[model samples]
Every structure is written in C-alpha cells, then in structure tokens.
Target: MGQLLDGKLVAASLKEETLQQANELREKGIVPKLTIVRVGAQPSDLAYERGALKRMAACNIDVEVKELDAEITQEDFVKELKAVNEDPATHGILIFRPLPKQLDENAIQYVIAPEKDVDCFSPINVAKMNVGDKTGLTPCTPTAVMEILRHYEINPTGKDCVVIGASNVVGRPVFELLLNEMATVTICHIETKDSSKWARQAEILVVGVGVPRLVKENWVSEGTIVVDVGINVDKEGKMCGDVDFDNIVDKASMITPVPGGVGSVTTSVLAKHVVKACKQQNGL
Candidate 1:
C-alpha cells in the first residue's frame, strides 16, 4: 500500500511557523492583517471564508471581511477595493473571484495592490510566479501542492512529472513550480489525447481537473508519487479526489487523501502569504 501524505501535519507546521512570525512582528508593534473582499453570500465563498478565518486566527493574524451585495455595481466595487488597497492597516487582500455577470473582472483584476494581493490575483504576482520569482505570492492551492512535496521530501529534480490540468489556478502554476525545481514537466488538458499514456510514465503525478475519480488505477504506474488536488462530490454524495484512491493506493508509492490533503494545506498557505506580505510591507 502507498504511504499516505497527511496534509494536516504540513498545515500544522506552516501554521506554527506563521504564528511565530506573527508573534515576533507583534513584539515589534506591527499587527499582520488580511482583508477579504467578497461579493454576495456564495456558499462556496462562505466555506472558504470560514477556513481562511480559522487559519488566520490560528496564526495570530487579524482578518477583516467586507461583504458586498451581489448586485453591487462594478464602479462601486472597485471603489471599495481601492479603499482597502490604500489602507495601511491592511497587509494582505483576498478577493473571492468569479464575480457577478454585472461586474467585469478584467477591468479591476489589477486594482488590488500587488503586495497585498495574497492570492496572486494581480497580474504582477502571476507574472512573477511564471518566471519562478520567489519574492511574489503565488496561488494558494499550487503552493500547498509544492509544500506537500517538500514535506514528503519528494524531490522533483529531473523526475518525470505529469500534471493533469491546465488551469491558471492550480495545474499550470504547479507545472511551472515543478519545472522551476528542474522536473521534466508535462501538462495535460481537455484536448490532450491519451492522457493516461503520459500519466503512466510519470514519476510524479498531480491531478487538479475537478472530476471525481477521473484518474483510474491504470493511469498510474508502480512507485508513482500521486498528488490529487481535485475536490469533488462523488455520485454517492461523498467527497473524493481525481484519483480513485482505493484502486490506486496499492499501486502508488505515496498518495494524498481528498479531505485531508491539498485542500487542508491551502488555508495555511494563505496565512503564510499574509505573513510574508506583512513583513514586506513593514520592511522587516
């Protein structure tokens, strides 16, 4: 059976490190704070808000949640974001995306200050990340995947790494991150013919396609290190990952579970980014 990559342990370690940094900053009379700008009360947004709040609290970071109406005008929304960006008290900003049809995200995507754009929503951070710039904050989920690999000491250098997704949020950034680490990276998307053929040859496999149990046992080879970043509800209403864990566990060398895997570490990465932003903003 493959060894389970426990995300809770990784989360705990990150939280502890962030907490220590927060405490030190507090001693220097600087309070690290994150502002979450959310429009409407999306259940998915609420769920992520709760997790971020909990993680921030654990790290001794202050959080401010600004809830806007779903029908708020784009001009008004941009005003609110600008207000937050100009606030010295706000060290980091997290904006829930996929705004209402009334709002044009493209117009305001770069409005958030790059230093406070903790989720890499700003194009500046995204560009920095694409070039392997360690100074900028990266997307939380992809960073969590990298953290899991580090925690497990799974070196990607020169390894055959296959990422089963091409999303800017997860797969693409992960591909870049692994490539930065000198891994031979291949990214497969919806148009890729015979994804499994590539997957079977990977020494490391990372899946974030959001399809439940999409990667079957045949997709992975023996001793493959599998990282499932997908979180979905199976037909039975149970939560699951892209890889069918039960079927692939015995064949893979190491695997991450659905609920306790990448998702669990994401909030911690958010906290880490906030702390980092705080330090940079304060010139610490």
Candidate 2:
C-alpha cells in the first residue's frame, strides 16, 4: 500500500514560511495586499473566495474584494479593473474568471499589469512561463503541485511524467514545470482516446480533470506518484479526487487527498504570490 501525501501538513508548512516573511514585511511597513476582482455571484466562485479570505487572513495578508454586478457593461468592468491595476498599494490582482459574454475575457486579462497578475493570467507572464522563465508568478494550482513534490523530495528528473487535462490554468502549466525539471512529459486531454494507455507510462502522474474518480486502478502503473488535482463532489456528495482513492491508493506509491490536498496548497501559493508581488512593486 502507498503512503498518503498529507497536503494539509505540507500546506501548513508552506503557509508558515510565507507568514514569517509577511510579518517581516509588515514590520517594514509594507502590507502585502491582494485584490480579487469578482464579476458574478457564482456559488462556486463565492465558495472559493470564502476559503481564500480565511487563508489570507490567517497569513496576515490584506485582501480587498472588488465585487461587480454581472450585468455591468464591459467598458465599466474594464475601467474597474484598471482602478485596481493602477493602485500602488495593491500588490497582487486575482480576477475571478469567465466574465460576462459581453466582455472579451482575453482583452480583460491583458489589461491587468503583468507584475500585478498573481494568477499569471496576463499574456506577458504566460510567454515568460512558456520560455521557462521563473520570474513571473505561476498559476497557483500548478505551483501547489510543484510544492507538493518539493515538500516530499520527489525528484521528477529522468522520469516519465503524464499530465491529464490540458487547460491553461492547471495541466499546461504543470506540464511545463515538469519539463523544466527534466521530466519527459506527455499531456492527455478529453480528446485523447484511451488516456489510461498514456497514464500507465508515467512514473509521475498529475491529473486535473474535474470528473470524480475518473482514473481506475488499472489506469496507473505500480509505484507511480499520483498527484490528484481534482476537487469534485461525488454522486454521493462526498468530496473526492480524480483518482479512486480507496482502490488506487493500494496501487500507487503516493497519493494526495481531495479536501486536504491541492486546494489548501493553492491558497497558500496565492498568499506567497502576494508577498512576492509586494516585494517587487516596493522595489525590494
């Protein structure tokens, strides 16, 4: 049987280090502030925001929520976005995505200053990330995945890594991060027929698809390091990961739990990004 990867413990450690640095900055009179630009009142978005608020408060980071009505005009929305971007006191900007169809999502993302884009939503940061530049902030979820590996001292070098899902937010960024670490990467998505065939090849497998328990026991190789990034409520309303924990746990070398895993680490990574942004903007 594989050992459990305790993401809650790992997240606590990461947040502790970040909190120490944040306190030091506070002593120097620099407050690390993150402004969340939320457009609609999405239940899922609200839940995420609540969790983020709790985490940021615990870390002593200031959070400003810029809530706009869903029906607001695109021009006014962009104007509101610029207000936060131009604010010197605001170190990081995390925008809730899937804007009203009237607004061009890509255009709004470009409007955010790259330095203030903590989520790495700006094209400038994306370009820097693609070319393997580590200066810009990485997408928090992917960074959390890397943090998990680092905390566990799991080296990806010379390993065959298979990444399931290919979205801009998690999968693609993770694939790039793994490649940068010298792992041979294969990215599979919804379009990929028989994804299990690819997954069985990985020494390290990272899955981000939202479907609950999509990976069966036969899908994984023995001793493979499984990082389950999915946060889904199963049909029975129990929180679960992409991989079937009970079954696959015995087959894999290590696995991360759903509620206590990547989600917690992601919030900690966001806090870290805010501090980094504060330092950069303060010219420190």
Candidate 3:
C-alpha cells in the first residue's frame, strides 16, 4: 500500500507559519488583507469562498468579499476588477475564475495589479511565472503541489516528472517548477497520443485534468509518486481525484487522496501569497 500525502498536515504547518507572520505584521500596525472579487453565485466558488474565509480567519488575515450579480455586464465586470485594483487597502486580490461567459477574462487579466493579484491572475505575474521568475506570486494550486512534495521530502531532481494536465493553473506551471528542479518533464493533454505510456514513464506523476478517475490502474508504474490535482464529482455524486485512488494505491509509492489532498493545501497557499504580497507592498 502507498503512503498518503497528507495535505491536512501540510496545510496546518503552513497556517502556523502564516499565523506567526500575520501576528508580526499586526504588531507593526499592518494588517494583511485578502479581497475576493466574486462576480457570480457559483455554488462551487461559494464553497471555496467559505473555505478560504475560514482559512484566512485562522491566520488572522482579514477578508473582504466583493459579491457581484451574475447578470452583471462585461464592462461592469471590468469596472469591478478595476475597483479592486485601485483599492490601496487590499493587499491581495483573488478573483473567482471562469468569469461569466460574456466577460473576456483574458482582457481583464491585464487589469489587476501584479503585486496585489495573489491569485496570479495578471498577465505580468503569469509571464513572470512562465520565465521561472520568483519576483511575483505563482498560481496557488501549483504552489500547493510544490509544498506537498517538499513536505513529503520528494526530490524532483533527476527524476522523470510527468504532468497530466496542460491548463495554465496547474499542469503547465507544475511542469515548469519540476523542470527548474532539474526533473525531466513531460506534459500530457487531450491530444497527446498514448498518454498512459507517458504516465507510466513518470517517477513523479501530477494529474489535474477535471475528469474524475481519468487515470486508472494501467497508468500506474511501480513506485510512482502520484499527485492528483483534480477534484471531480463521480456519477454517484462522490468527490474523487483524477487518479483512481483504490485501484492505483497499491501500485504506487505515494498518493494524495481526494478532498484531503491537493485541495486541502490550496487555500493555505492563497493565504501565504497574501502575506507575501502584504510584505512586498509594505517594503518589509
């Protein structure tokens, strides 16, 4: 049986570190703040928002929610983003993603200030991340994955790392991080041929495709370190990860379970990023 990569434990440690930093900032009369700009009433986003609120409260970080109507126009959405962009009180801004269909998110991405955009939504931050620059905040989910690997003492150097998702939020950024760590990295996507062959080649496998249990037993290779970044609802309404936990557990060296895995550490990373942004802004 494989060991579970306990995200709950990692998140707790991070919260402790963040809490200390927040307290230090408080003593200096600076309160770190995170502003969540939620445009629509997405049930998923609301659930995540509640989680983030609880997480931030634990670290003593203040959260301001900008809840907008779902029927808001694209121009209005842009205005909303700009409002937060100009708010000097907000140290970090997190916009709920996949904004209403009418809104051009790519265009809005450039509107948020890189320093205040803890979610790394701004083009500048994304560019910085792409070139391996550490000057700006990285996307939260990818950072969570890196934290898990570090906590578990999994060294990526000289290892073959296979990333199974290509979205900017998780897969591509993770591949870049692994590459920087000197890992030979390969990224698989929907169009990739015989994707399982590539997965089987990984000493470290990271999956973030939204399809539940997309990776099965056959995709597993002995001693593979599996990090399932996907959170999906199965036909039975049960939450699961990209890699099938039961079938692949015995075949792997370690794995992150759904609900308690990659998902757990994400909000913690958000708080960490907020603190980072606050310090950078205050010249601390």
Strongest candidate by lDDT: 1
Better of 1 and 3 by lDDT: 1
- Each candidate's clash count: 0, 0, 0
TM accuracy, model 2? 0.96
Per-residue CA lDDT of model 1 for 224-283, tens digit only, reads 999999999999999999999999999999999998999999999999999999999998
TM-score of each: 0.98, 0.96, 0.96
Write model 3 residue lDDT over 1-284, tens digit each, in one string: 99999999999999999999999999999999999999878998999999999999999999999999988888888888888878888899999989988788888888888999897888888788778788789888998998899889998999999999899888998988888678899999988988899999999999999999999999989999999999999999999999999999999999999989999999999999999999999998
TM-score, candidate number 3: 0.96
**Each prediction's whole-model lDDT (CA):** 0.95, 0.90, 0.92
The per-residue C-alpha lDDT of model 1 at residue 132 equals 83
Model 2, which residues run further than 4 Å from truth? none
* Clashing residue pairs in candidate 1 (N, C-alpha, C atoms within 3 angstroms): none
Off by over 4 Å in 3: none
Clashes of 1: 0
